[model samples]
Target chain A: MKLVGIAGTIEDHSYNRTLLKFMANHFSDQVDIEVLDIQDVPLFNQSDDQTDGAPVQYLKRKIEGADGVILATPEHNHTTTAAMKSVLEWLSFKIHPLAGKPVMIVGASYFDQGSSRAQLNLRQILESPGVDANVFPGNEFLLGNVRDAFDDQNNLKDDKTISFLSSTLKKFLTFVTTINDMNAKVAAADWESEDLGAHGHVDTTIDGLDMHAADWVDQATKKTNAVSGDTYVRLDCGVLTVDQLNYFLNSMPMELTYVDANNQFLYYNHQTDPENMSAKRAPAQVGNPIEDCHPKRAIPHVKQAVHILRSGQTDLFKLPVPSDGSKADMHYYQAMHDKDGNYAGINEFVLDILPIVKYYLGLTGQKLVKDPNATDALTGASKKSDDAKPDDVSGASANTDEAPAEKPAEEPKPDVDSVSGASANN
Target chain B: MQKFIAMVGTNSTNSTNRKLLTYIQRHFADKAEIELMEIKDLPLFNKPEDRKVPAVVTEMANKIDAADGVIISTPEYDHSAPAALMNALEWLSFHITPFIDKPVMIVGASYGALGTSRAQEHLRQILDAPELRARIMPSSEYFLAHSLQAFDDDGNLVDEQNIKKLDGLFADFQIFVKISDQLKNAHGANYEEVRNLDWNK
Candidate 1:
């Protein structure tokens, strides 16, 4: 298969770049791979897409010609780099070369655990409607402690790593070949002349075989109806079922633990991914007395907060939890009340506010841009499903407000110095 | 050799509080046998059912029972110790009472300016409860603030003041444990007399 390997970093000596190069060279016998340089791809601007640039056209043509795309990405602040997102934005708006294209993602990081989060995020982006890249499921090639994993020649040194990468490549190749063969069979099938069932409709026959599309649709509709029935509770914003409320709670970056007014540990949201969660809640802690949840040493303080909230002295209490310096830890306790303003429960929000704190403090070298097409310009690579519709593309557009702009064009040292100086007085 | 078990409060893999315990173990290498205990595996304390005791809890109790003294290096979360550490303590307090009359020292490392002063005070209150009846070292409270910067890459305490304070605290703890052990062994009514003796001089 002819593949286009996109190194998702612009750094001159990026490990991700070297990793892609190594993959291209090592897998030369099995697949024809060409590494695409994204350094000269101008920052994504929706207004300028109508007047295509040479580099943009070059990237689009290369992607169009390739049978599969390989993304080797570097993570920044627990997400994919801004540079990688910019490339996706430029490609997604117009031609949508990624749509129905076979893609695979891999990443390397200096930490003991590689860039798994970034790879997950990238898969989400690729699967989104506009991109619609057929990302391989459950295959992650994370080269951790990458500096030590590779040799002086930019080749992977460890036999185990090389074997793992080789196996993953083989699996990806099989997946691509299978998809291509299936598509070819479906295309060659004469569906027009196929028998129409009793309803005088196409019988959902594919390649002279029954697809059972009707049964699948019926089951899906029934499941959706069953899930949405009378399980909803009215909220200020809208009606939400217990499952929906849990989804909203878990969707938040923070972990939440709730204690009722009677000082009972009521509930905690089950984290979707335990590895990514900073705080873990065991099931046994639920239904226990709130006082019992805390160490005896901290019981008095827990009581005081409850008492204060019960007495209507304060509605909220906030504290910054100490961290090991990698992330900022903040805790917020809000007094929950009933419609009659009676104290109902206490809700605790444990958040890693380092990103927000750093952003405001200007400690982060992230750039901010103001553009009308900003929303469409950068979409989260997440929120894609295997059957995602083409029209479902708009929903995945990332909120421009949340996307950190590309890093400043110049050196970052001076910016850090000035920002630190400004923050010193605060 | 006097064996001391150190329990760190937080379950974070990158916990600075755990790093502080490692620093303590290194600093007091010649003084006592400091065993760094992990509370991550201990199930949450539940009544009646947990009273029968899981094998893991039984093992934890056994270790505590064998140890001469206990050291707790904690990080304050929501102005208290994390749930994992508390759960372990509750298990011990309920089933074993191993902390009763045990010489326990509390030290904390935090990212905040106050370190874990509030948590230490709260812990002291808990240890002094009638059922637990732990004899805590009251002379000094080692609260390391900005703990991320307190240690070097090699896990050694970098600040001279912190190093000096830890040195004194460990020495005082050793003396405290020795006296406490002597008092525990003292025959029937002699405990009152032994407790009144001026060990400071």
Candidate 2:
């Protein structure tokens, strides 16, 4: 499980921060806990919205990607510090990354009360309609007289305290799973709201053009004065000409397609004839809404897949194609996110993994057989398997995770790259 | 006339709470010499080891000390008073005792129908803390709900009932201020007690 630790204090030295650091190091094996710094976050003033600012956006993206969040707070007055409150205000205002996200509160204090009042105050604030964070119940880890709580290397000296913290974290993880599962089930029916008509306009949605037009790609390229051929385009890590970019993408083994955040089918690697491709996508289908590109029967499934991806429920949705008992084709719908982790769109790719499986089996001298424990594995299934890193979903989008923040990450422009993750293909 | 400092809670450029305070200052002009102060300019409190307050905070404390009472007009954000106001209060109580034994009236305005009701309660608890120990007027709450529509073209409160309630509260606060001053037997002891507390030490 991945979690992010937010040390509520922006101070140079704080016991609260120390507590979080100790938790991160001690429980390093149990979870991926990245300690986020809040010093750069400006105070929340509705008059001055720094919501789109780098510091706040960084925290948002980090929290969005995390399975759960741990907030280590210090007491100021009888409540959480103003810095912590300010951060919460920013998170809740305009952008709600904490909404429906599971959060755990831990605190430390110089007094005997050990930030008791502050934690309660934090709970109240988090439960407000705007924040709406699912705070864990009944586990208050308050480190009192925190001055003597730690040793030379900042490790907690008390074994009893350490063991309690361990148990609390384990319980909190279980709570996180339960809450996420509940949210998925409850929100599953709400996916019908996904507007596949491309009615909503993004910044890149070209104006005064029919999205359903077969000549959309040609018209859009001309209207935008888009570069082509030897025109050099600067990428995140390298500079490549438009022709070079095409050559690289077209050489990819898997048939790839790009549907933008607005649900507009924008591009496909037209490497071969439509009949010869693994996924039969034509060049004329470019710039159509995803609804226009798929059959009526597939609309509901498409909407659900895109909805889960867009909502950050999961990063990637994969399903097996029911082929004529020959081709073991798999369709992967990977949710793309900007550097700030906003859902950009879907990077749908189809590839027959049979060749790779056969090659692996031949090299390893192993035979393909069903396990005795397997009850329903004869036909192609979703396979909710991220146990082993499924790194074989190859494409230019694999590099999108590392997209530079200097430019708009979700922009349909060639330089933009975004986030992607995996979910079972319900 | 009793002098009272009206502290506007939020740092937002446009706030109905500030409008409410402005209306109160003018509406109760003859009743009390109300001076408006903003918590916006004060820096966020980080609990410095030296325990020295900023110059702006000291200035605020001086004004509060000079005033006979304080009337805080607050706005709710995430079901609590804005952090800017909380930050100012933190600095005030960190080293100085501006609010100790001082008469305080908590009033709030909100765009929503709740009128910052929960936040006013929260502020009451904060002021009642040992570090603050403010003498808040009891059995009194004047929250202007749907405050956006409560004001008129001239910025006067449009509702006659709200005006009547505010007038009665202002009178009560004046009386409460005089009564609070007479109840200062433990003020000196409380100051010493607060000063000697094992804080940040």
Candidate 3:
């Protein structure tokens, strides 16, 4: 199968285009690779019909002939490049060449953030419109510090980057072949028609956005709840779920965070009352590099946590609860896992049990005596108190077998970046 | 008077690398002319009816061909060079093998600690391709780290220490370009031999 790679630049010395050139040359023997030039293609507008035109004709021919297409592009403001969108627009007008077509988007940027947001956004856009894209769960070719990677002669000089790219290309090649074979079968024997009944139409009631984020959060909450079931918390990809996330935030006294596999900020719990922190912060920080948040000294520990989490390991890191004259120490238990039981990333759940400590210290339950000031309501604990420390908590069970009222424990607010229930494809 | 050219290629609107290049361009303004080439203007590549090329393509090719030496300020993406930058380089090659035995210096910067190391390595491999005739700066010579904050508000390399590394890298690149010119004038016997070997093999 022939695989075609397209680069999204028109410079005389674009490093990304050169990488495509090298890949083309490397794979020239096994596959016929062609470099696409978008120079002649007019700005994509549906009104301008170019069915028989030169640029559109070329694009259609390429898509029709090739088994798969490789798109290498630059991230522009956390979204797909205008040039790339133009190509899609052109395609969408005629044949929708991207629909169900297996494509791989790989590119570079100087930002250590690794263009994950841009790539994720592009992948979503591509898949949003009936287009199927093969997005790797993690970054496929995230090359940081591009400035030093090439020589003056406009060639890539990095070895490990090349090695990994070649390996990744190998996987892409396999996927393309498999996809091509499937397409061929569907076309030749009407296989898809026969199996149409088995795979019915997908329900589109919920926008793909909410469907995925919701699914992710639901799974995450279920997993966390399953562990001891005493703690109630919520995790989000970013700070978007403020109202729902705040339920968790106000309920818990500890800070919580949800990050993607690459450690991009998904969501962060806001410090309650905001008396000490900035009120309005950059939402873009939701997808910023995790390392940017910590001091240089803490990088090693963060890296270790990431490694352990990525390798399907759950780690419990404990910090002595701060003994600020009035508070008891706290414990931090971080559970990291993918929704499908794979290693997606990490979640930091901060539990401050200082109030519990206070309760445990004063180990006596007091009953109110009959007095004019002792109202009936004053004899029992308030609903909020019951919810805060339910009957399940140690030494907190009320006497008699009567089921206690279900109190609302504050759920850990979604991290500042979480868009839980959003599709992982993004 | 010796001629020199500085080219900035990046996709970011507020590119720190571009700002760095702007600083370097000002430095060269005293001795040479510098131009900033924006990749955003170029259209996507299409192979159908590959006929007359676009004007920007021709303009870019001409710039690279006429330049005495090329200094590239690249931005890293996804652990590699941005495909936009890579596409620009490919388009340049298609017009005229401006990369063959040409004096080229690659430098990059980013907000990250290691700079564009991944992109640097990726570019190194591309330049080292069997068909491409080019010289590469050693890893130690390539300066790129914490460069976003390295520049002053005036768009000058404010960090004296980093400026020193850039100075060293550019100085070596200058020498490489001069030597390359001499070889080009001398019929580039070594480059021809390499090309011939590649063709015959």
Candidate 4:
């Protein structure tokens, strides 16, 4: 059970590195762990190889000699520290010390989720071709609310959390033995294989240019020599000019969008400017891959919704876009099929149904009242998973700015010029 | 025309991410005024006991405070943002809150196919932190994969599609900047919260 530990941060004072030191001493009876420092590991650059550098050599020799390694990472910008990543880059480049080594991940953060994202990212990086290491699976050694996790003696204070950590490490010792004995090559996870970039080509895909290009409309038009202006175009139901088709689609009550079968955002109705529209759509956003039009956090949900519609699991998937106000927006994703019953694309339409409901009530001369048995979650607004809602992110400081408590000031503000002088007055 | 601060999020002497930012600046010359900033000089953030921010960081913060918007082009290292960029952010969010409520656009370039996908995602979370609170442009990303081959001899972007993507994103970013001004309801509360932050607690 010989192991080497490296904290993901090079900060002068880091809870993650301290957590590693605690684990090494506390679990000395069960396992032998040596803590390493990344204080002098410079930022990684391919042109500036630090393989022969003293700092890198120190860790490389130790990692190569160890049976397993434990990475206690700190979450920075939702991932492992750049210092830790730099160390990995040097080790993986021209020297594969981490290759085939057993690795376990643990992390601590100021808030909850204790570096969850960073640990996942580290696993991905460690399993990469360059730094191919076998990572222990399933156990999530998360130490959240880490500021108070330790006492003055530098030992973990929580009995439950400490017991959990002890058990997780015990499992890790077993994981190391099993992995080292079998040396099995596991298949990639289900989620890892799916590419959201939408790079795969179908028959209608335009290959010459990037699908995310800003001028895709003009370029695609030129490439295809598409008819425009008053040019006549034959439709399935009738014949009309290009201008007439545009006028017809734009005049629709709901904002329309077309996402092709290949997951490309091919078209959207832009009758009004972005500021006025219920859902903003820029002309330049017309030909982007679907993922580009949404924040990274929403990608998983986007893929799920598309899959349900694409796989013939459902003909229509409706979502209520949440809003605090009475703007009860509704979004519908209707599946469009080709003549032969093949899934072609989605015809998504967005509209505020509140007006329609109001109109109905007015016509009927009726009043509106809340139902006591109604579930709020079922009818909640702001449900568009693709939308970038700030609430979705963990805003840790949302409430901390309230009236300061009467406790003594932690760090005297003699640091620099006052940043929020006006805030004090308010 | 809008004014912007374009930050090269890496310290490497030879970085395609820097080249990407340069391309954005030159390509959008007619639409906006763009000034490129480097994070290389800022030291790695160690949370000095004095709580004093470095002079260079203060200079950068002042520039960011004055700009209408910011464009950050990052290079992915080991599936996350480079330490140099994160180090710079650590200082920016420490005491000076220039990023607070400022309009920001995230773009990236990579030597491989993923194009810094994870790093941009990670950066989004960091910018969303209470201390930073940057109003990142919604629903848009510009990932320049195979960046080494993405540019020409004059540093102009070689691929027309990537050029268009950057163009579209920049155009959207301008609109986003204007809209950010309307989201001032939380401005006061945001500053107050940041000022009272005690990370040690």
Best by TM-score: 2
User: Which window of ten consecutive residues has the lowest lDDT sum in model 4 chain A?
Assistant: A394-403
Tell me the whole-model lDDT of each prediction, alpha carbons only.
Answer: 0.67, 0.84, 0.55, 0.80
Where does model 4 exceed 4 Å of error? A184-426
DockQ of 3: 0.03
Range of the 10 consecutive residues with the lowest summed lDDT in candidate 1 chain A: A394-403
Which of the two candidates, 2 or 4, achieves a greater DockQ against the reference? 2
State how far residue A26 of model 3 sits from its true place (Å): 26
Ranking by TM-score: 2, 4, 3, 1
Query: Which residue pairs in model 2 clash with each other?
Result: A315-A421, A316-A421, A316-A422, A316-A423, A337-A418, A337-A419
Candidate 2 lDDT tens digits, B19-56? 99999999888888999998888776777888899998
| Candidate maximizing DockQ | 2
Error of 4 at A262 (Å): 50
Find the candidate with the highest lDDT and give its number: 2
Interface RMSD of each: 22.7, 1.2, 11.2, 2.4
- Please report how far candidate 2 places residue B5 from its true position, in Å: 0.8
Error (Å) of candidate 4 at residue A199 is: 41
What does candidate 2's lDDT look like per residue over A102-185, in tens digits? 999999998799899989999999999889999999989999999999999999999999999999999999999999878767
Q: Model 3, A1-426: lDDT tens per residue?
A: 766677765445455676677778766766677878766666543334665688767876787667788777765434445466556656764456665567877776665644555565556556644245444334367655566766666556887777887788778877877876575444423311221111212221112222123243344445444332334344555433435546766565656666555455456576644343222223334434555554555454345434433432224433333334355433333546545445444566555466775554344333224456544232222232233122122112121111223343443333333443544453
TM-score of chain B of each: 0.88, 0.98, 0.81, 0.97
Residue-level lDDT of model 4, residues A1-426, one tens digit each, is 799999987778899989999999999999999999989988776767788889998999899768899999987655677678878888887788887789999999998889998888888888877788989998999999998999998899999999999999999999888876554223111323334577887778877987878999999999989899899998899999999999999899999999888888888878889888766789998889887877677665566556656654456755666677578776767779998568888898889898887876655455567668655453422233224232232110111112123353443333222343424432
Candidate 4 residue lDDT tens string, B1-201: 899999999888899988888888888899999999998877666668788999999999999999999999998766667767878888888877999999999999998999999889878977887788999998888899998898889999988888887778888899999999999998999999989877666
Please estimate how well model 3 matches the true structure, expressed as its whole-model Cα lDDT: 0.55
Docking quality of model 3: it rates as: incorrect
Show where candidate 2 strays beyond 4 Å: A195-275, A281-297, A314-330, A334-347, A351-381, A384-426
